[model samples]
Target: MKFCLALLSLFFAVVVADHGDHSDYVVKTGEDLARYRDQCVAKLSIPADLVEKYKKWEYPDDEKSRCYLKCVLESFGLFDDAKGFDVHKVHHQLGGGDVDHSNELHGKIENCAKEGDAAGEDACTRAYRGALCFFKENLALVKQNVASK
Candidate 1:
């Protein structure tokens, strides 16, 4: 009986440990981004059809997709209510103090934001557009960074 109880306690501990908090969702590398993409879709309750479209690089331009992007960005600490796209946080989180790479990426994102009317849209909409732009334009650099790791 004592052995069974000990085994049950260990199982419960392992289960609790595996259930990581929100920070676990943050994507810091290419592999992490890939994993979190599916997790974010499920967590945000994005529809299956939309997920399929997004996987095919087709922007649905819909609210559910927008919300999923927002949730993913928020998990990465890239988006905030008071300061949209917290560049410093993103730099620290994704670049690991590589100021030069961070600056370059930041400039690219800034340029992308400039060509848009994100201010007129809701938070989710803006995040979706920004994330799409970033991924489309800067995925190479991000993947390179992951490779270097």
Candidate 2:
């Protein structure tokens, strides 16, 4: 009986750890972005070619690429039709709850999104636009984080 109870406890612990909230997967640096990209690709079943295109920030020219962007954006909690982009969620995820840093990044992203021609675009177009804007705006940070890692 004790052995069975111990096994049950172990199982519960594993379950809880694996199914924790998205907060557990904060993206504070380039390494974190890479990991998030990997997770998104795996979870969304994005094709290798599409993944490559995404890495280059190329606009999605095919359905698979578009779907890949959609999956990635949704996973990052940066997607919203009515609100355009969830800057706060993105800031929290990438800044690791650093309000000042997140706010600064958020402002950059907001400006980029506004300047981009995402209005009236299709789902894929919008996702690609938003992603392009984000990557472009944070290229320096991405490079710095990746280099440090």
| Local lDDT at 79 for model 2 | 69
The estimated TM-scores of all candidates read: 0.61, 0.56
Model 1: how far residue 129 lies from native, Å: 2.0
User: lDDT of all the models against the reference?
Assistant: 0.66, 0.64
| Candidate 1 off by > 4 Å | 1-27, 92-97, 101-103, 113-117, 143-149
The backbone clash count of each candidate, in order, is 0, 0
Count of clashing pairs, candidate 2: 0
Quick one: how many clashes does candidate 1 have?
0
Write model 1 residue lDDT over 28-138, tens digit each, in one string: 775665677788888878778888886655667788888877776776667864456755455445455434533676677665554333566778777777767766887
How does candidate 1 score on lDDT? 0.66
